[model samples]
Target: MARITKGILGGFSGKVGTIVGANWRGKDIIRSIPNPSNKPPSEKQMLQQMKFKLVVSFLRPLGSIQKKYFGLNSGSKSRINLAVSYTINEAVQIVADVPELIYNKILITKGDLTGFQDVAATPQAGNKIGLTWEDNTVQGNAAGTDRVTIVCYCRELGSFAVFEAAAERSALAAEVTLPTIYTGREMQVWAYLNTKEKNVACNSSYLGALTMI
Candidate 1:
């Protein structure tokens, strides 16, 4: 790859013969398009591709939250990119050549803001979830007005139930009733605290899976 500086075409995009021109991080660059390869992928390459696929599938749906809270963006890498990388490296497990997500290791949000303390989730009647946490409003970077967010993923339904601003940090507890479709299904729950304005957030806590009553 080579940066284009005052070229005749002035940083043109799209294909120009064998090389492709494009803008990256406010700079224009050109790189040769790789020749099509007929060779098969190696085992290691396949494994890596599988892991990447699994992580992308799970995280893409949560792109809005991840982009805002996953991590600080670096240069060309955005927060969503960082989330994908982290999930692939730290949250995926392989069994018999199949990549599976370790729910406990998954992070719905990651940031420096103070997180929940001793958070717990319990299944309640009528397919509701009762969430409780210790009062940590005075803890590091925490505030009584910080709002709580909940995320519940149902693998059986291949869907998620997200509740944003369900409560405030000082409230210490909240309840969310799942949709009728989620009745009798097991869900993996997570919770996090964010500023009332939703501009900042803390790392999310995985509150364990529970079967809806």
Candidate 2:
């Protein structure tokens, strides 16, 4: 094998016949074109491809939600990546060909810390969602929580709203005003406690559906 060092031909940067030249990580490199395959996909290949499609279809729309809500608050991409990866892995089990990351579709927490005791949501007139929760820390101490993260999901319209509120030493309840388009659609609500120790969050508690007025 011939290794063409950068000092030899300087820096090459285009495709020439069967060989392509490019710079990767500040180093110039050259490689031959891959041979085309005419073979049909096997059963396992088809199944794996279907699984990937299923997972991607479900997870693709979540990027916006993650970017808008979790990206900043979590401080790093690790947590968001973990959640997305886990959901994708779980998407392999699609009994009815449903491609969605529902509340019950996968494990919510990576740790055993208890989440919110009880949570409920109601839609007020002005396209507002009022959320209430009871802290389980009083009776039993879980991981010390710093904030409550609420996910309001509208299953019918594929829309959502995210809210965060202070949780330490307090019951931690608040409301979020959604867009006017979300007024008439029913929604599912979930609550999870984010710990004081950063990047650690509690499992989600299904707060049930809300009748948006």
Candidate 3:
């Protein structure tokens, strides 16, 4: 059987250009879903709608940073501390399509500066397993000065039932991990003539997994 792993990276923000204020607004990430109706919608349309939903529920909250820091003086350096929250709930529908049978253990890694809460796991099918994580808190020094990264890994078991059914089994097992880093940017929301700027951004991210074997 073959093993597969996928990584996604996004949320890039750069310094302001000639444009008025900062234009580093958040955007949503989406996966393709088949349309049930014959004339339902085009793939682009479906994806756009999904993106809109994600922006509304996850990205819009970040706009508060602008409102809170609207009065900063011109040419004064300021940060936009925004917290964008997101959730992942993906279903493969067919585990055989994955071509891999995972067993043993799974591990997740994140920065010590962040706190993760409310982790849950569930098995939905005979050959499938599901995991969910949420509620992450980011810590930064002097507000809007810290960043956090997240990574995950899973161990495979050669003795798993699915591996047993395969005609060929290797003595070695493979481990899966997300290679890209999930980043949180610092935003300076306020700045005074004598005092420094301060901002607080808090958000959560979730990953859903379905494993076979």
Per-candidate local distance difference test = 0.90, 0.61, 0.26
Model 1: per-residue Cα lDDT over 82-179, one tens digit each: 99999999999999989999999999999988998889999999999999889877788899999999999999878999998999999999999999
Write the residue-wise lDDT of candidate 2 on 129-188 in tens digits.
776766566554464355666677676776657666534525557777777778788877
lDDT of 3 by residue, 62-148 (tens): 344333422332332322211111111221112432212121111111112232334343333333323333323232221222222
The CA lDDT at 94 in model 2 is 52
Candidate 3 achieves a global lDDT of 0.26
Cα shift from native, residue 68, model 1 (Å): 0.5
TM-score of each: 0.93, 0.60, 0.19
The clash count of every prediction, one per candidate, is 0, 0, 5
Q: Which candidate is the best by TM-score?
A: 1
The superposed Cα distance between candidate 1 and the true structure at residue 185, in angstroms, equals: 0.6
RMSD of each: 2.8, 6.4, 22.3
Candidate 2, residue 208: how far the Cα is off, in Å = 2.7
Q: Which segments of model 2 are wrong by more than 4 Å?
A: 1-36, 42-51, 57-82, 88-101, 106-109, 139-145, 155-157, 166-169
Which candidate would rank higher by lDDT, 1 or 3? 1
